[model samples]
Target: MKNIMNKTATVMAVHRERYELLAENHMFYGKLKTADFYNVNERVEFPTVGDEVEILFNETGDSLITKVLPRKSVFMRQTMGLPDQAVAANFDYVFITMSLNRDFHISKLERYLTVAWQSGGTPVIVLTKADLCEDRGRYLEQIYEAAPGVDVFCISSLTGEGIPEMEHFFAEGRTMVMLGSSGVGKSSFVNTLMGKEEMATGGIREADAQGRHTTTHRQCMFLPKEIVLPSGERIMGGGRIIDTPGMRKLIVSEVEEGLKSSFEDIEELAACCKFSDCTHKSEPGCAIRRALEDGTLSEKRWKTYQDMLREEAFSKERKKAMMKKIGKARKEIKAKRG
Candidate 1:
């Protein structure tokens, strides 16, 4: 091992108290410094897959991770009582995969789109299992309606359909993160792209169509420099991809900007309301009300928007309360030390 100090590396996988790192084209194991990360007063940002980090080389054992470098893009989600979880970092595209079978849901797609936009990366909807779905056109229409101005690709990993169209996204230096619920064929998709079974694949329950979690951890995989398709075409660009376990509950927080971007049509209507302070319910000349009544916007879509807004507000309040509690606890600790 080179006797280098403060070397940079990309986090490949994060196990509890351990990390898999790729530095200078070599794979190395790493561990965080307790003083700098674990015993800090301020919250420390833990390194996740796709994160660039500074490390101290250790020829003897695992390298020491000193700091987590700033992220250009990050995907995160938080539950109500738990702390925020960073799913992946430094990704260029979020592949929102949803199978066309029982896994397809417009609301779920919309939710994923909101988080994807908020992550500072382009969101591309990838509808998987095209071979299984008979009414592809209907599902495609629903997707187009739900995600306006977003790119959508319908592909079957089994048959290699629509895989060639996604070749451009695999260009060198680009990184894409796969985001979807369990059983949506994310591993299969990765396997297909790799031209081999790089990740394990699982089947969904036949009765409910709900998928089992084949990928239980988040890890970054480097794409092959050249991938030859079964159809005799070659994908000639190398990139990186981070695959995460399926999130059963994707509770979003601090995604106000993402909401506005995802629901631009609804926001536009609200902007045109006659009263700036209009409640949008009983107010006269309310653009939203008029649109709802005139079939311009579907009621289901409007309800989803309202529900997300409420959820966002609730999450904000919860975070504030949690922070206040932590501050109080810190003050008590300081007093004891004094």
Candidate 2:
């Protein structure tokens, strides 16, 4: 085995213990070093799609990944009965995709925005299946109200409507990660952006309009500089796009900053309350209560914000408890060795 040390590569895909790496335009398979990653006292940061890593390259076989480089941004979600899972890393933008049909829910969008903002990447709302929605004005209005100061694009991947307006985000070297539930047209949007049918498209259930999982794994693809569409239109693309499997559950934890940013209006109102401890429930001089009474803040939005806070608190406690258990296990192992 010819070994080349300290070569850098980007993780393009991950499947359990195996990884597909891209380095200097060449693809190589990689596996983690057990000593460096698995047999450590502290928790190891596993490689994810879009992560830059140091590898001991092998010309004939799987390379040994030595270290995962620091990520500029990481998108993660909590998994029940397991640790927090990293979805993607080092992305510049998070495309929060949702369909305009039955799959669209304002509460879901708000939840996505909170996590997207917390990922250290700018969030851009991508509303897909415009061709299916006859009246999009109301939906757009709701989105604008919920996500002020964030960019939003409404596009139909089938017809290419609103596709041209999103070309600016595809500038060279920028990376975007698609985040949404299944059947949100993420694959279709990727194909359109690539100006070809590179990803498989699946149909949603007619009864509920939920999508089937067509993309099973997370993979990154480099976009060409120029993509010519079938409609004789061309898109200038030079960035990278990571397409991930649809997440069935997106649980947010330790997202205080994200919550504040997503619900800035509510935050500001709370700050204006007469008492810092005011709970907004039958409390005198509660700004939140006043806003609710006057209709400045919709009851539904306020309730969603509160629900997220409760969930976050619960998740944090669970994580703390899990960490304690892990620490105890490590101590027992050390005692045995001694």
Candidate 3:
């Protein structure tokens, strides 16, 4: 029953009924106290990985999580057909890693860009396993065509090629989160950055570029002190990195600014349409339609934008319905009490 409160800490990992937190240069196990449960409107409140929380530790028992601080950003996706659940939080950059081999797909990259933009973090496109791919330039061109104005890098963990360029993002006080499907060499990349095999790596099918998912849980690791870049530049306390288990589906949720940011070119083109409410499907004087017709816009990219818009709309509706159900349930409980 430690009454002292406001012990700020960062959530490193979340497990069933238990949480791992980093506070005051130490790690501690914590559990959510009953009083910490939020009100009805916040029925979904819980600390996800990277959340900064206030806690109180009992010497002879596990720490009690008193509060979950507001998150600067959250990476979440729908789980098991349920509402979106957070995967990580408070990351400054999202490393959207994808292998340059058979796993490369323009549509998948677009989906990741949408989710990264929606997560309120800067998205960096990292094309891994460059050694396996011959025409890196082709994939680079496709990346720019799909996600314009985002930083893109092609790196090989085996040969240390292009690994030095990533050092700029690892400045102190910054955090980066790796996101992609399994077999993208995310762990390998981290190991290369760490100068050792901090994470386990698995073999992938050389044909399809698929591999067994090696990372079983989401965890954060601090970069080594005084990291030396391949360019011979030394940087101290080079930020933090969180490795998450590869996800299969990245279903986006209610994203207005994210959609606009991810598809800025499309939105700008739509602004010039003859009708303010033009859907760009079959409308006359549609700038987007003209762009698609004239090869100014890739049809595949346009379709990806449209698909994300539909998904965002659906997510918004789903959230509204869930909130309605929660409100009704609260009212019923109040009536019963009365």
User: Which of candidates 1 and 2 reaches a greater lDDT?
Assistant: 2
* Candidate 3: tens digits of C-alpha lDDT, residues 1-338: 54565588888888787888889898889998766575543564588888998888765678888788888988987864355688899999999999998888888888888889989899999999888899888888888988888999898888768877777798779999999999898998888777777888898767766667898778788898776544455555568888887887777777677888888998999999999999888989999999999999989888888888888788787788877877798899778888
User: Candidate 2: where is the Cα deviation over 4 Å?
Assistant: 1-4
For model 3 the TM-score comes to 0.91
TM-score of each: 0.96, 0.96, 0.91
Instruction: Looking at model 2, report the run of 10 residues with the lowest lDDT sum.
Output: 223-232
Q: Give the TM-score of candidate 1.
A: 0.96
lDDT of 2 by residue, 130-169 (tens): 9899999999988988999999999988888888889888
lDDT, model 3, position 138: 87
State the C-alpha lDDT per candidate. Answer: 0.90, 0.90, 0.84
List where candidate 1 sits over 4 angstroms from the true fold.
Answer: 1-4
For each of the candidates, give the backbone clash count.
0, 0, 0
Give lDDT: candidate 1, residue 275: 98
Best by lDDT: 2
